[model samples]
Target: MSGIYIHVPFCKQACHYCDFHFSTSLQYVDEMTDAICTEIIMKKDRITDQVGSIYFGGGTPSILPQKSFEKIFNTLTTHFSVASDAEITIETNPDDLDAKKIAILRQLPVNRFSIGIQSFFNEDLIWMNRAHNAAEADSCIMRSQDAGFENLSIDLIYGYPLLTDEKWHSNIRKAIGLQVPHLSAYSLTVEPRTALAAAIKKGKQVPVNDEQSAAQFISLIEKSGMAGFDHYEISNFSLPGKHAVHNTNYWRGIPYLGIGPSAHGFNGNTRYLNIANNAKYMTQIAAGKLAETVEELDIYDRFNEYVMTSLRTMWGTDLSKIERDFGKEFLNDTIENSETFIRRNWLENKNGTLTLTQDGKLFADYIASELFLIDEQK
Candidate 1:
């Protein structure tokens, strides 16, 4: 079984630090939805597996015009073999949720709400140019609960210039105290071509400090551990049984189909992404072309992807699974490359699993790269 992801690429406004493909212009909303539904039908035969989860993610999926949401959901139901108990998640920003709106969403098959609460501080939200305020952050969750939606996830952005260490702890406490089942926390990064990057370039915003980000991440780990939520992935924490089944499947290399502009699809050895331009995507899909670029994953590519993703999770790299999937040569090369980190007490191999120590996680990407089997240039 696989999952289906729909990217709603319209946001009320762009966050200063976000570089995701989205547009503030609302002119193409109807056209985009129609294109997405058409894309779904055209790709149905391409995806043969049953969809275990259906996720609406993006530039604030909650911002979808109510009728647009209805159309997309109805189209999915018509075309896909979605499971009755499937985990349906919708990514919404706080400002988009109100009592009446939450009630309407509750009427749908969506069982989970993933709210973008980047920060609970009004000033930080303003600095990031988010659409919601601090009050909206608290109110949205309570309103959803009041509307009888129990499965809730909140996202937090830590390690910004103004996010002090104490404040970071407070933010985590806010989620924990709310009894929210899942928390997706990320360290702020100034992506290229983003407003945050421009602000820093103009000397109006402070550059991100690696040391500060590291400290704040450590704070997140400690507090989440204390709260009994497993730091399951690099940037996600969940109470027992609260880990997002949809995302866990992705990390496990399960196949999924993504529909909408800039959406990505992974089917068997091939990976494809649709054009990021909204108008271009709609026009091409309307003309019967998928407007996607495809790539085939070779042995080295698969091994490297395995290393990068597994190392970010608490599960780490399973030597047995590696030997099974990639071959003994790949597994041996991985262990040999990890020796230096092992000696430094950063990585430890025990019971056939190479897991990271808390300290080692601070430089996860670099460490994973050292073990990457980047094939020789040919």
Candidate 2:
């Protein structure tokens, strides 16, 4: 089944380390919503399959007015064949989740929440310039649960200078105590041109330590294991039967239609990237244009993408599918190239499925790149 992703490009505050496309000036929310709805309607005939998931990710989807959600849903229902039990998700900040707001959301189609609770400590929140405080971070979950929203996922950031080992442990324990169904943890990376990078360069802030980050990552795995959560993905943990369907579909290479500025859409063989600028996107949509670029994937590109995504999951890579869909040469190349990793016990090829061991997950990106077929090989 296919999916739909709507990007809300406005935020209340700018986090120091974020590099995603977003704007703090929210005066353009109405115009942006209109543009997104128009794009969805314009491409309604694009995907005839039933939409299994609808995700509202953003600068802050919770910041939008109730009418925005209504309008978007109205457009989607009218134009596309949305499934009756579609997994609808929204990304929110803790400060935006109040009782009144939760009550309003419970009536909508948002069945799941991906809260950006980066840290449970006020010190870290201030360091990251988050909009919410420690109290709000801890309370939003209970509020959502009280509102009868059971499917909950919270994001936690590790590997920052201010995050100590003890504090990280506390963070994980906090989620366990809250009985959060899913957890997505990430290492703090200093993107170029971000405030964090600039502060580090100017010695205004402590630089990120790779050794410390690696140590924290290992701690996360062990802690989550003790809590009975499955490390299904490199940075994601979930209780049984609590995996994120939308993101799972993405890793499995299912096609999805992306809406709003800076959104991306894929159809197994081709990719579409929307214009990143908000004003320009709306202006182009007003002129009856899609404001996007498309790319057609070749055999090598598709093979490499499959290797990258499948290898990251617990399911591993399917050698038979490779041989059947690609060719014997590609399968042979994969098996031949995987010899060193297998010998090192970093990878295991059982029944023709190759999977990364616990230790190998730290180097997942490196291993995937090594297994990639180069231009000459293709």
Candidate 3:
């Protein structure tokens, strides 16, 4: 089954470490909305598969007014073959949530809420330059629950320069206590071009300690596991039967259409990315062009993608798929490379499926690299 992702590239404030395409100036929201809806219609014939899920992710999808969301859904239903039982998700910040917002969202097709609750501490919120504070984070979940919404999810950042382990523990425990169904957590990495990167370069911001970050990742695994949450993906944990259908589709290599600025789409053998600039994307789409880069996937690229995405999740790399899709030589090399990591107790081959052990997960990228199909696979 395929999915559709709508990128709402507007936010009220910029997170220092965020490089995701978004603009704080929302003056172009109305035009951007129109361009996005038009693009969906224009690309209606691109993928003929039934949509199993629809995800609204972005700078903050909840930041859009209710009418904008309605228009997006109207366009989706009008142009795509969406199932009646499709799992529709929207990413939101706590500040934009209220009874009015939740009620309005529920009235539409949104079935899941991926709330950006980066921290339960006001100081961490401020450090991240998030618009929402500790108070809003505390109240929004309760308010959402009170509004009769279940299947709630939250995002958390750990090992931030300002986040102590105690503080990080508090954040995780808060979400657990709130009974959030799904949790997506990440270690803070300062990307090269972000504001946080500049601050650290000038010694204004403290550097992130890899050791500390690794420790917190371990903490997340142990704590969440003890709490009965499935470590479904390296960065995601969920209650049983509560995994994100949209993201699950992605990891399983399902096709999805991504809309708006800086969005990425994959349809098995090909991948595309929308232009990163808000203005360029809007103007191009307004001119009836898809503002994006496209690439035809080669064998090496496809095999490597499978290694990278599959190794990061509990599903591991499937040997049968490798043999079938990538051929015998590719499958053999993958198993051979995994032997060293398996000997080091970093990975496991259980029932012919290669999966990451908790210790191996800390170096997941390195392991994926070691197992990547050589360039000759191309």
Candidate 4:
């Protein structure tokens, strides 16, 4: 089954480390909403299969009013076949989930919440320029659960200078104690042009330590494992039977439609990247046009993409699928390239399926790069 992803591009404030496309000002929210709905109608033919999942992600989906969501849903149902049991999710900030907001959400079709609770410490939150404080971060989960929404996931960030080993442990323990079924923890990385990068360049902040990130990541895996959570993906952990359908589908290379500015869509063979500029996206949609560029994937591009994404998951990369989809030559190259990593114990090829070992995951990008099939013509 396919999926739909809507990127809401408005936020109350910017997080220091974030480089995702978004506007802090809510000046043209209504225009943006109208344009989003129109784009959905225009791209109605993108996916013919019943959409099994719908994810509202971005600047802050929680900031949108109920009417906007209602309109978007209405437009979606009108144009396409959405599965009755579709896993509809909204990415939200902790501060947005008050009693009133949770009540409003319960009235909608939303079944899951991906709350951004980057850290459970006020100092850390302040340093990150997060909109929510530690108290709200602690209470929002309980509030949502109290409102009868239990399919929950929370995000946590580690490896920043302010995050000591002790604090990282506390953050993990707090999420586990909250009884959330899923957690996504990421190491802080300085993206160029983001506030964090500028701070480091000016000596106002220390650069993120890679060693610290790796150690905390190990601790996260060990702790979550002890608590009975599956390290399903490198950065995502979930209890048994609670994996995120939308993201898991993305990793498995299932096609999905992307709505709103800065969102991306993929069919099996091509990718559509919507223009990141909000104003331009809205204007183009108003003119009954799509402000997007398309990339048609060649066999090499497709094979390399499969290797890149599939290697990051618990399922690993399948050699048989590679050969069946690409060719025997591709499969042979993969097996031949994987031999070195297997000898180093970083990779394991168990019965034609190759998965990263615990140590291999730390170097997943490098390992996958070494295994990629480069096009000689290029």
**Candidate achieving the largest lDDT:** 4
Q: Write the per-residue lDDT of candidate 3 for residues 21-125, one digit (tens) a residue.
A: 788888988998998898899778877988999999888889898788888888889888899889998999998897788888879878889999989999888
Q: Which portions of model 4 show Cα errors greater than 4 Å? A: none
**Alpha-carbon local distance difference test for all models:** 0.89, 0.93, 0.90, 0.95
Name the candidate, 2 or 3, with the larger TM-score value: 2
Error of 1 at 22 (Å): 0.5
Worst 10 residues of 3 by lDDT: 369-378
Lowest lDDT sum, 10 consecutive residues, model 4, at 40-49
Model 3, residue 122: distance off in Å is 1.0
* Candidate 1 lDDT over residue span 1-378, tens digit each: 899989989999888899999999889888988999999999988767678998899888998877888888899888888888899999999998998788788778889999999888999899889899999999998888888888999999988899998888888889888889899998898898998999899999899998999999998899899989999988889999989988987787889998998999887588889899998999899899998999999988888888888888888899999899989999889989999999988899988888889899888888999989866784
How far does residue 61 in candidate 4 sit from its true spot (Å)?
A: 0.4
Candidate 4 Cα deviation (angstroms), residue 109: 0.3
> Residues 1-378, candidate 2, lDDT per residue (tens digit)?
899999999999899999999999989889999999999989887788999999999889999999999999999999988898899999999999999899889889899999999999999999999999999998999999988988999999999999999999999999989999899999999999799999999999998998888899999999898888988888899998898999998888999999999999999999999999999999999999999999999999999999999998888899999999899999999999999999988899989999999888988999999999977854
Error of 3 at 123 (Å): 1.1
Model 3 clash pairs are none
Which portions of model 1 show Cα errors greater than 4 Å? none
lDDT of 3 at 216: 95
> Tens digit of lDDT per residue, candidate 4, span 159-267?
9999999999999999999999999999898999899999999999998999999999999999999999999999999999999999999999999999999999999
Clashes of each: 0, 0, 0, 0
> Candidates 1 and 4: which is better by TM-score?
4
